[model samples]
Target chain A: MSHGDTIPLHPSSQSDIDEIENLINASVHQSVPSARPPSPPRASIPVSVSAPSPSPFVPSNLPKSSSSAVPPPPPPPTGFGPAPNTLTEPVWDTVKRDLSRIVSNLKLVVFPNPYREDPGKALRDWDLWGPFFFIVFLGLTLSWSASVKKSEVFAVAFALLAAGAVILTLNVLLLGGHIIFFQSLSLLGYCLFPLDVGALICMLKDNVIVKVVVVCVTLAWSSWAAYPFMSSAVNPRRKALALYPVFLMYVSVGFLIIAID
Target chain B: MDPNQPEVENYANPKTCFFHVLFKASALAFYILSALFIDNFVIIFVVTVLLAALDFWVVKNVSGRILVGLRWWNEINDLGESVWKFECLDHESLARMNKKDSWLFWWTLYITAVAWIVLAIFSLIRLQADYLLVVGVCLTLSIANIVGFTKCKKDAKKQIQQFASQTIASRFSSTLQSAFSVV
Candidate 1:
């Protein structure tokens, strides 16, 4: 312990210790996945080489570094190499992990009822991204179809959708059924997938009847998908109570989709 | 909700709990005071109603849930029947709520309603029929919130009773079934 403690006394070893501490923080605490091999052993070689120098080196380095209140310059060789490697690799890995998580969530929501498999596990990892994407995408398409003030149309549509989701969640919750706040929000957004798909198709076509039929079908699909979970939230007496607002909002959105042209 | 259970006088958030009363009191004060300063009837009506509406929203959505562990709403069902719904934290959490917060919430709620009613009576006596409309709207909202929350507390009690009975019934049935199977 004494021999190890004596090394930090040397001025050159002081800078080296700071660099090693940074490296340790970056490696262990950061939890980054790097393509490059572990480089800390190579970084520590210089520190070991400087350790055996005289105690006189210690006082000279301490005063200069303490006054500056900044870490000394990292050593020349391996410092520049690993810095770039750390940034790029883990970023791509994180993106892949998050994207896959979003995709799995979408499947759980958009496909059929997966909650039947394990009710506890359903929506265990709810996120706002799916809701945000669905709401914004629906708003943008409706705006494109608007004859005038597309921006106002987008704002109104976005606000309505967002507020509708919150109010609907509160409605179910107040009816005495157990529900997670964000999970319901996420589920509500996913229920809009059918409507979103219908919106995409309707925006391309001009026939009023075609838009009506498509909107009606998609609206029913959205409401049907949302019904089981929302109805189950309240007592049997209040099942219809909790679900009406949900269908009402979906109906309004469908009407907006059909009537936009 | 046992009467014998220890009362929790301490608040989970003692410092900020006053803000609930602060908001309701300010909303009421604004509505009552705005008439004396402002000449425009439309401005008073609109702004006061807006403030009341904001308070209703906050009390319904945020404060009731946080301060007293209750939530309530009314909605129109498919057959055009209006349904009033109420939810509360189960008995344990309700018992754990701060005594001071509940006192403030219930007292402030009833006082606000009473104040609006008095204002309504004063308007009636003074023959200021126009202002009565504003007071009436505000009073209706205030009372609606109280009714909903009152029903919620009762509903929570009913649920506890039902749950206890149901658990006992199920356990008894299971034991009888096992005994019959052995025989």
Candidate 2:
């Protein structure tokens, strides 16, 4: 149909158009003449129907046989067919086919890389390596600081252990059990050998206000570390898992710092 | 929504608030620690104030500006790909604008990196180890910021390219479908 003629049909009564469409669909199916002969007969009907209509609904420039020239027949006053049900199986089947094909192709295209499908492994790597690296560096720093000042070596070592524990705990909360446990164990040597770092530091420092401040600071940092995982970018379950290690790390650091100071 | 529009306000993410509170608390704790351990009150006060100011600037300004730059980059890149479909600006003009903006972003990153390195080195030289440790923690917080900006840039580039690729692919498929139906 000509685009101009189709414009007028849009505002026509919805039920009337639907009834007309149903009638046309039924007629087409009922009178399914052999494909070779039916085309010309179907093409001729519009030419005969449009000859008398001079209304605005008809486009003058359309080919004489095209449907654009014919005014659609008025629909019956009452509803003719069953109310439209929820989408039928055939409609859903087509949608499912399209979606499955798209998803399959996308998966194939996106998942060829080594890390693409193994996010858990990636999280484990980050959790383990991040704390491992941080602890080793912290140990070296503490060793050097201890060498310079003999009395504070135990205190520094304890602080590092607490930092490691807190980091491990937060990673667990963020990454989940597998990563958290791996990270915590990997860093456990530091925490255990550091001379009861949290308690030692708490004994050395006598002030209550400093201990309270340290606790508050640690809580705040833990909350910060956990915040990004809570974003829409990360999966909810993963975010929850990641926060555990963050919480542990924060508390551990707070306690150790409070003890040392 | 037009991603091209400049970010008028900092879209405060949960991370932003968390970092703000963390940094503020860290700063306060460090100041108190320094007051207790180190005898130089004036120097500690000045450094603490400066750190606080820096943290505030980061929490307020950095992420939003980076996001704005990223959005502009994507819109310009998209415009370049669909230059023929748009009538207002020709391809050459759009390409020039894209080049200019992209360079601006790179320059900003370069400057920020240089400043961070210099500050880190200076802190190591001048500040006490405890004070430097607090700075280290603050600096490490930028790991998140860097990751976020990198991800934004990467995603923006991917999205723009994907949109162009999808449009071309859909058009090709539609044409093939019509041609096959005719046959």
Give the winner by TM-score.
Answer: 1
> Would you give me the overall lDDT of model 2?
0.37
Q: Grade the docking of candidate 2.
A: incorrect
**lDDT tens digits, residue span A1-261, model 2:** 222333223253444344334444444334322311222211111101111233221112211111112334222112312222111113345346435644443332223233344323222212222333334344433333332442245334535554656665555545433333432343332222222233333444567885565456435633443333222224566665555544565465555445433
lDDT of 1 by residue, A1-261 (tens): 122333332254354444443443344333222422232321111111111111121212321111121222222222222332211123245347547868987887566573474442445556556776788689878888888867567657866897899999998878877776777888889888889999998999988898999999899888877876776667889888888999999999999998886
lDDT of 1 at A133: 71
Worst 10 residues of 1 chain A by lDDT: A44-53
Residue A161 lDDT in candidate 2: 59
Report the CAPRI category for model 1: incorrect
| Model 2: per-residue Cα lDDT over B1-183, one tens digit each | 234432442332345344444555555566657767876533453455456545544432332232222211111111112110101111111121232233333334334334445556766887556545544544554433444445543443333333334333443454555558669
TM-score of every model versus the real structure: 0.41, 0.32
Interface-residue RMSD per candidate? Answer: 29.2, 24.6
Tell me the deviation in Å of residue A2 in model 2: 23
TM-score, model 2 to reference: 0.32
Proportion of true contacts reproduced by candidate 1: 0.00
